[model samples]
Target: MQAFEAFMDDLERVIRSAGDSGRGVLVGGDFNTRSPTWDPAVSNRRGELLERWAASCGVSLHNDGCTATCVRAQGSSVVDLTWSTPSLTPTVQQWRVLTERETLSDHLYITYEIRGPRRVKSGDGGGHARWNWRKFNAECFRESLDTCLAWGPTGEDQTTLAGLAAWVERTMTQACDAAAPRARTKSSNQEPRRLTRDRRAASGPHHDIEAEYRASKRRLRDSIKAAKAKAWEDLVGSVESNPWGIPYKLVLGRLRTASRGLTENLDSETLGRLLTALFPRGEGSVPVSQEDRSWNEG
Candidate 1:
């Protein structure tokens, strides 16, 4: 309709003004248009026109595939869309619909964050350990723990509850450290986490035959490596084509994340103390009797 076109034109003007001022632009709402680009359903004339308008305005579509943004008694479709200027696209992380949020409308709630440079926390330079669950030896862990427990009540630790708890905690920590593998520093050249997880799953003991699992694992690894190499090549090509563009901005983001380092891990003693402080013991509190439950009867 003429009215819809006029409204779209006004939105384009606002987006252009923001981009021209060197500020980020994020426009998101019910577009009332359907396209296969953002959903599995068929396309419409309005969606095509909107796509053209976005291209001309230098805005990128941030909606991920096949998620139903609008649901009704009839069915579901992805009518709602999120658009961001090219400068803001790389910074937009986790652009997805919050289906659990009750909006009391047909359209689902969408959320995203424009991430900034991460600030490095103190004591995070020396990386902390995290259990590599994929390589954990459960049998080994059990044996180690049993051995430690068998040698119980050693020294004055048995005299006090705190000392006994500390001793037990130390024993468990020792067993876990011995039996579990630690995750290493992640490289910038590492493949995507999703792909890595898929590869791990393929290599797991789910296949009927060992050879089938091995073949699947090989294929997944090869595919992931090829995809990573191709993506890097494309990024390089883009940088070469446009010296100051989205590719450059994305590279800057990667550099910032690489320098931020991993988060520090809290020890069990500190975690326990924090939990205890947050949920203190109610020594003198009285328990409510069942006879006082008059609200349930009503």
Candidate 2:
């Protein structure tokens, strides 16, 4: 039992490391545990531990249909399990216990398909190469753009309207690429910053150190405020400049996602009913009745 616990710990560490490195991980084997989380009939210490471990490691069970994966002459149980990283979980398709396959062992075959990441065409200018607006270096972009333009378009590039337009676009893209690298992953900037020293000690450890810590905290707060203000300004400028660009798409997507709670599973008739309930159509404001006026006066 101690050895098994150590093994589970190691497995969790490995899985977490792989996930942090942005690798798709698929682990399938006989875990030899019984938990109601995976199997409907049994819950054991091992199974509970495994469930907790998988949750901490950000792995999800892909055991569909809850079919038993182990069979013996005495009885049958679900010992085999399939686990995948969060990013790979959705790609695990057709997860099922292959009861018919002859494995010549107690554990039945668990099979699933892992769909690979979709490959975007190079010239599509997909999100893979989208400009990183948050980290854009304006001065660098200006310098790079000036250098590119200084080369001057070749005679052939300026011969036609299409050629000139393409040349201009290509130069701008080159400058953008140099100044702002693509962000492959989204990250939050709102997470609280960690103090240089633990706050407990900084609160009353030493007078000078406390003063320094207070100054540091103030600086951090000011920087956070400035960053937020700049980001808001940039968002407003982007929407004003290009109403149909990334900022607009991002906001629209957020609004659509938020609206899902209000709109999900609602047919047109249901939507109309809800709209009418909230806002009854009238030609104009109707005069208040005597009873309503008495209630208001009371």
Candidate 3:
């Protein structure tokens, strides 16, 4: 216990450094601690200490009410856990257990998705140029480009071909500069992308709906969070005293899913790859086979 406290103190030091630096934090693994906040089935001394540590650090536990992280003949345990700071909680769009995939360990696989600013493309950011087309005066631009096209020098034979080429390029570039092209998105002073969409697209009479829409969306997310916690609690209660109930529920879930259409509209190449296991590869085709199709299946 003394050694565990030392280790926890060291870990907290790193977490504190991350918070002070304003860097997002994500720490996840088999914690081997059980808490009512995360699993609801049980709570232990170490789990209580862990909660206190997180609260002191202003980090949120993300594995709330998640169960069956480790399953055995006797029962399932929510030993696997994930933790993130306040700066990171909003960025985690989804977090759940991967029940479809089973490992040699009693522990199940877990996954979480982070939704935030994508890294800027490296190596000169090669893509089509973006201009302030929304505010552009198209008529004036057309006249300017047309004048550039008409005014090329037929009399520049006095200069070298290279000089004439440079002159034309300079003229066109100046015109384009005057046209006010931009390379990045316009910054918004308030609200988010979705809220901005709601506000901007609102008509005069329907403007009141914008605020209501925002509130409704917030409520929906909160409701989902609460409902998931309750659902997991119910599941744990049902299976706690009956180990056989776990497999029964698993079989029923499989049956329900099997009744639904499993195949989606797939492009030819993707469809071929998806069906490769059931269908032999055609002659001359590259022998590429994916044993684990769980990449996007979840």
Candidate 4:
């Protein structure tokens, strides 16, 4: 019992750490224990403790109360339980207890939808996502950068590394904002197209943003279905045309999902390089860095 108590303490710490990134968490296993929330066959001390632990942490119990997670010759018990954080609880579309299984253990198979982070489109009410890298104007960006970098950090501002970093970030952000401002995603204020256009739009999508972003996987479902059908068609066409060249592999490929239109995931070294790229000093200006020469290039 002492060992079990220690395990529960460690479990809480782990769950807290997992939720530190502001994302939902899922912690589950055959907890050789029983609680009133999940268990039905019997009651025990360990199960009660687990219930309290879950309640204190604000986690949601996923057991349907009557669904038994285990079966034995003498009797069955709901030992295998699942616990989810509030953020992830609603995303659980379904929970099931599989009865038929070829296993020695009494514990039945438990299934639930543990959703991942739902990344939205560029202009869905919030993210500054209209960054068209394909159509980026290099010359315009260069001129904007130069204009911003001309007013470099003064001698007083260059006293500390932190100050220099702040100055560089401000300069780069200003330049980017001025030169290539991100396009806004409009909802419905545009001029109406013909009925044909409306029909085409209906075949694809209409809503820019969803109310419940977590469980709203309608977009993902439709997209995968469409891709699968297109891939099938491409394979058929390729077979009909050549039968040797697989056009499905070459032509029927989708572009990678883009970033959130910002340089976010950067280490200390990479961050230094990015700053240097934004502000490479001229002859009269203070040197950015000797190691970041590649970034300092035109």
RMSDs, each prediction?
40.2, 30.9, 33.0, 33.8
lDDT of 2 at 7: 89
lDDT at 290, model 2: 80
lDDT of 4 by residue, 118-163 (tens): 4336457565434445656777557545533433454434577886
Superposing every Cα of model 2 onto the true structure, what RMSD results?
30.9
Flag the better candidate by lDDT, 2 or 3.
2
After superposition, candidate 3 runs with Cα above 4 Å error: 117-298
For residues 16-105, write the lDDT of model 2, one tens digit per residue.
Answer: 566445465789888889998778887888988888787666566778627888899988888888887644554566887778999998
**Given candidate 2, what's the lDDT at residue 83?**
81
- Each model's lDDT: 0.71, 0.71, 0.66, 0.65
The clash number for model 4 is 0
- Residue pairs with clashing backbones, model 4: none
**Per-candidate TM-score against the hidden true structure:** 0.40, 0.41, 0.40, 0.42
TM-score for candidate 3: 0.40
Q: Model 2: what TM-score?
A: 0.41
